[model samples]
Target: MTRPWTVRLAAGLVAATAVLTGCSEKQEANETLPTNGAAETTPELPPLGPEDFPVPAEAREMTPEGAVAFVRYYVGLTKFVAENSLDPEPLLQLSQDCRTCIRIAQSLDEDRAANRRYTEYAYEFTGYGPAMLDGETAQMGFLYVQGPITVVDQAGKVVTDRSAPTPVELQSGAVLLWKPEQATWVITGLTVG
Candidate 1:
């Protein structure tokens, strides 16, 4: 005789529970439980900070190649900040009293506050010119191409639109200082046309 729908459903659930319990027991047997009879917990990870975008070993050497690598990394960090709309503190930490850097950070902060974000546009460093190094300072020129930009607010309202039929090209330069203590390059001057 066929059982009632409710009774069959109950039986199915009981069977599933038994199977699951058996699997759990097997898994427990395979695992090494704590000797103290306490539940195991995963180790917590350290908080993320500027170290997330660490200076590459190549960028650490005090050489022209190192300067180029450092500049590349800096541009990459800038792109990361702009694309993710993340805190500009990391970018600021890489610079020392740089007016353009401060302006970029302030713009990011304003965009965040206004709930505006960039879409369908990115900044790319096309090429890096020769790096000039003197003592603790280095200067380099780079070709920057920015794609057509579109910014939208929280309500999807177009806040700023720069629909350049062609990507806007700018000649940018940066002056970096080799900080011995931090073993990194810090931007002291920045300019972008």
Candidate 2:
């Protein structure tokens, strides 16, 4: 049987994989501005680049909702991975134009020997990044290092850690990532963040 920690680690990696992607979604009006009764304008960031990833930042400078939203999208994408038992689909949900995302997605479908079955997924990120707000478009720094992954069975009770080979924690690559969506800040690119 797989190491118990391996399962936990894989869950963590899966969660990290969901966020640090290269998909580009449509931007909303201005979703980067703070919701502290300030002008709802977008944050200043470079135009959608090829590489993006979640970076470290402070909590006060971020919209708690947007930050939470980013995590939710990532977790949902992980579910996609578990449901389809693939990779690129999870990557695709994170990005619409990442070569890696597309390639990974295709491989998930092509590689039928990947997973034995679909199950539950969960992730808890303990890092921070620059979550910019612009009108309704929010751009989050696309580079992050998510850790301590924990996976559960269909009944929801499993755990793991880094280097467990179960994909538990994720040491994101040297890619800068950002979310380009205007109304919602879905992770849209990968970079060296």
> All models: lDDT?
0.76, 0.43
Alpha-carbon runs more than 4 Å astray in model 2: 1-64, 83-94, 112-123, 127-130, 134-137, 141-183, 191-193
lDDT of 1 by residue, 71-120 (tens): 88877877667667788887788789899989988887887777777765
Give per-residue CA lDDT, model 2, range 1-193, as digits (tens): 8999999999999987777653454546776755678567755543221133222232112364455455444544544564555544435554546555565457445533533343433444433454555553444433233322333334444423211223244433212233334322444443322
Give the top-scoring candidate (TM-score).
Answer: 1
How far residue 186's Cα lies from its native spot in candidate 1, in Å, is 0.6
Stretches of model 1 off by over 4 angstroms after superposition = 1-52, 161-166
Q: Count clashing pairs, candidate 1.
A: 0
Q: Estimate each model's TM-score.
A: 0.68, 0.36
- Which window of ten consecutive residues has the lowest lDDT sum in model 1? 43-52
Candidate 2's displacement at residue 64, Å, is 6.6
TM-score of 2: 0.36
